[model samples]
Target: MPQMSPLNWMSLYILFIFVFLIFNIINYFLFLYSPNQNKNFKKKILFNWKW
Candidate 1:
């Protein structure tokens, strides 16, 4: 197999990261999140603390 140069590897890494970020951003906005529901979601995530 032909070895990739550092520049090629760097470009591939950056490309994958860029694609991953775009995918996450798309998924984030794909949901219809209202402020009220956002608050409700956060409230549900509260951990029950015990000492």
Candidate 2:
């Protein structure tokens, strides 16, 4: 098997880390601003009332 150079591996690792951080930040903001929490709370209240 051919081995990758250290520089090549480092660059690939950096790129993967950069992409992962960007996606995670985007998902964090989406979750932070999500409107489903209100609906979920309402559902939970109604569910508890039924039991």
What TM-score does structure 1 among the candidates reach?
0.55
* Tens-place lDDT digits, model 2, residues 1-51: 337688788999999999999999999987796455453454334456766
**What TM-score fits each model?**
0.55, 0.53
> Highest lDDT among the candidates is held by which one?
1
Q: How close is candidate 2 to the true structure, as a TM-score?
A: 0.53
Candidate 1 — worst ten consecutive residues by lDDT sum?
Answer: 35-44
For model 1, state the Cα shift of residue 35 in Å: 8.0
**Candidate 1: residue pairs that collide:** none
In candidate 2, the residue pairs with backbone N, CA or C atoms under 3 Å apart (3 or more residues apart, or in different chains) clash, namely none
